[model samples]
Target: MRDIKIIWDFRGPAALKTAEHHAIHLKEYAANCAIEYTTIDIQTFNEFYTIAFIVVKEKDMLSVRDALKPHRAEVYIKKRRD
Candidate 1:
């Protein structure tokens, strides 16, 4: 299996709020998709907002990425062998 980090930037000042919103949505979506092992992070720097997710496999990671694409911009995904 491989590990993957899926990330995307949020365009606004409300980074924390946006992250929290997406976290909630992600939780529900993950449960429905049967992906149990993942971590979601909300990062902010000055005027930048980003959401990051680490998962154990590319298949699972891509599933989450697809789910978040509509609400996120500049999506980036990284993968590593486990």
Candidate 2:
């Protein structure tokens, strides 16, 4: 199994409510997929993007990525190296 880092960028006003909304939605998404996920803030020129670190079994990579397609507009994936 390999660890993967999934980054989701939310574009909009950089308000507290916006950030909270992203966190809440992501939390639900992760829980539903049963994937271990953690989130952090990434600074950007216009808005703040949320970067989620998801650790999943290598064999389940495609499945998990597909399941998260709803957020593709702001999502990205990468493998973690030791």
Candidate 3:
């Protein structure tokens, strides 16, 4: 099955920190709710932009998306270890 990335974007001077903190919450939520996910992480685009994201199976996308209300989503392609 494919994966889906659910992203929450943050912007401002504190974007990176906020995104990092948000990723922690995403992990907690998944643990508490028994949600299956491949990864949860943060990405910093710049000082003013960052994002927190969780990658889950495509089958789990709708429920997670409804509960999390993320800013965006896309197909997640996992990088193969070579």
Which one wins on lDDT?
Answer: 3
Q: How many residue pairs clash in each candidate?
A: 0, 0, 0
lDDT of 1 at 6: 59
Best by TM-score: 3
Candidate 1 on 8-76: residue-level lDDT in tens? 556677766776777677667777778865465666665655564434365566566676664433323
Model 1: lowest-lDDT 10 consecutive positions: 70-79
Q: By the TM-score metric, which is better: model 2 or model 3?
A: 3
Structural RMSD, model 1: 4.9
Worst 10 residues of 2 by lDDT: 70-79
lDDT of each: 0.60, 0.51, 0.95
TM-score-best of 1 and 2: 1
Worst 10 residues of 3 by lDDT: 59-68
Please provide TM-scores, in order, for all candidate models, with all chains considered together: 0.63, 0.46, 0.94
After superposition, candidate 1 runs with Cα above 4 Å error? 52-56, 70-82
Model 1, TM vs. native: 0.63
Off by over 4 Å in 2: 15-19, 37-53, 70-82
